[model samples]
Target: MNRTKLTPLDAAFVQLESPGVPMHVAGLMIFEPPAKGGADFVRTLVSDWRKETRIAAPWNQKLESPSRWQLAPCLKTCQDPDLEYHLRHLVLPKPGGQVELGQLVARLHSQPMDMRKLLWECYVIEGLAENRFAIYMKFHHSIVDGISASVLLMKGLSDSAKDRKTSPFWIQTAPEKPFQPASFKMPSVPAMLGAANNVLKLFGRSDSLTTLRSAPRTPLNGPIGAQRRFATQNFDMTRLKATAKTAGVSLNDVVLCLVGGTLRKYLQGITALPTESLTAAVPMSLRAEGDLSPGNSVGMIYSIIGTNVADPVLRLKKISQATNVAKQQVLGLEPEMRVPYSIASFAPAIARMLTGVSGKKKPMFNAVVSNVPGGRDDKYLRGARLLHCYPANIVFPGMATSFTCYSHAGTLNVGITACRDTVPSMQKLALGMEEALCELEHGLGLEAHANPRSLDVVEAAL
Candidate 1:
């Protein structure tokens, strides 16, 4: 723990070789407290964050090998507020609610996290439609992922709001002990020779890097404008699952198909779009059950979102095909290789810092559409019911939009994050998502709980 070297996960975050890459993933929540108690909510979160940081193990230590990674936490219950930042939460002007929320989110996408501290932030926003409020949090993607992220959120919320327990998040229930990084074991002579031979073979074959380079040169891959856009939507997971089950696929396949339908409709709104399906890069977590002890365990797949197709069921089939191909490509990559190339790792930290000072090029995705797995169990906070959890991911150039969902209490909370100015009428994209979900449900002859529409989608375009 005395060293200052980057773990593989840390290296991925610092050396963002990918373009339009979001540094961290975040979740936005709208809470309806019974009454406004000044600083009560903030105090609760600060207290929780204080306890959480005590267990946060930084990735500054050496590992037994490049493949092994882990994090270590201190005992005696940490109370370090320095581990997190309390961003100023500004209430929007009159009538400015989700509209302004979208604006702030767009601004956030354009900014980058500081490398000096662990990348994380928590904001408490006041003045929603009425007495309700909101909270937004961002964390470096190198840590836990969306599903793992939701687990942390659920854990923070008390099962009983009035339980009045004095448990430190740093200390686990039935606590075994804090984890320490395992020692690194250098490869033996035979293993080293094998890896060296594989590298030479790959150099001559060029099979691994071709699929990544084959990404078409679109506006989504080039330089980006500073201005951003935001869009969101919520859908019925029950319906999505039913459709996916009927199609002999997964809810993920359903999401891929539905988004394909939505994008095709969106393009038709603009003008005649290409017949070739639009490509999307879906990130895949490489974390095994025992891997989350340290930093990031992740990779990505580049595949066609299947946007050009016109049929829902047919589109689902195509999406399934593309996904299989993409997954195969990712599996074919070298185990030690990361999703984004790490050429910058060869330079000093300062040199790597300079790359993002202005902007780095070489984006790999037109738009990212990820479907994170979420819990199906119901969860709550101190008396306050956990209604919804909206996710807002950070943005990079060429790729300004992304999608994610969390399943809690038999309901699916689908979240969207996008660039404001660059994307056209993103709000409708949100509404269209509802409409698309409904269409999907209706197509499958399944029942839905409600037909609630996503806030005013049309007005936002103005």
Candidate 2:
């Protein structure tokens, strides 16, 4: 059997899975029909996909044992995967716009994937008003992190629109390497002692920037229901870059500040704004350059998102400072120690979840915000133009909100997923994000672009 064991970090995702929280990450992609294709384009694509019953690695693999924390599930390649079960064809109702698309995604994302089969599913959706089709595919976090999954998705696409022979993402194959177990190794005695000391210093520090208990209690930190509400907002990459340049910070810093400002506005609107700043758990990819192998390679950093500050420019400065401090602390550690440090830092929260004390204790962070890079140039699948790709990520038990953004083809696409009951009118937050961006630009004395190029038509249709 071609088998691979899940790493402790990856296995934790399996352990944390429950009826309320589904530990899966997904991508929602909108594609324009090719010039030569007719009204039956998406149907033809589905027919071609269903004809190929042979599945590929990862997608064709299932758990060796049930994924309980006690059983420690390992993945073994299976001979057959039910194509009909893994792939589905759906049609959007009436409006066929982003609003309707988001509604459909929220419902689909709320349902958990059956662990007995492959831990992935893809939906080919047609009937979009503008004649565009959409694809929503999700994979368990144990199989791939955001970067690795993005690489796999990109592999199924071509930079040239004229390239019509591109294969589907699942069937792409790589040169087989000898199977080395994916389990985490116990560190050497000396390394173990060093890691212990490092963890203590990382968590024991009293500095406001480095302390683990710096997160503020907000409405966003609470027990969540099974249902989820998802919203998306698009931004012009050029305007964002200009803001980053003016502030002398990275684009991610600008994004953090924008989200921070939006959260402040939303909370104030609901009369639940926290007096102190809220901390965010920012995810950092630990994958080596060009290392697109499947499975998780992620670490976490805590940043003060500057929610307490009302001035957008100053808020961005504080966020940038906090992020830089957190990055420096992580960079100070050896590459091998970084992941362990992150796990250690997050241990308290995980313990709370396991002990059924999740929402009763202080949160490690108020929310999660992740930024993933996508293809800078336009992408095409069998000559169909790729418009935008938005990411939907996991929200933990205590932290009920997650914001994941993807930058593709000169646009920054933001996806907001939250507990449906706790976060009301989720679209308000999405609109607030747009307002925050404009506010930031105005505060920086720069002109803000009206709207992202790709979202104009979609918004009009909505």
The most accurate candidate by TM-score is 2
* Residue range 65-101, candidate 1, lDDT tens digits: 3221134221122224353353445565655566787
lDDT of 2 by residue, 102-184 (tens): 88999888988787788889999988877899999998888888887787788778999899776677887532334556876
lDDT, candidates in the order shown: 0.55, 0.82
lDDT, model 1, position 220: 41
Q: Which candidate is the best by lDDT?
A: 2
Off by over 4 Å in 2: 69-71, 174-198, 201-210, 452-462
After superposition, candidate 1 runs with Cα above 4 Å error: 1-4, 17-22, 34-89, 92-96, 164-210, 213-219, 328-364, 442-450
Worst 10-residue lDDT window, candidate 1: 60-69
Candidate 2 global CA lDDT score = 0.82
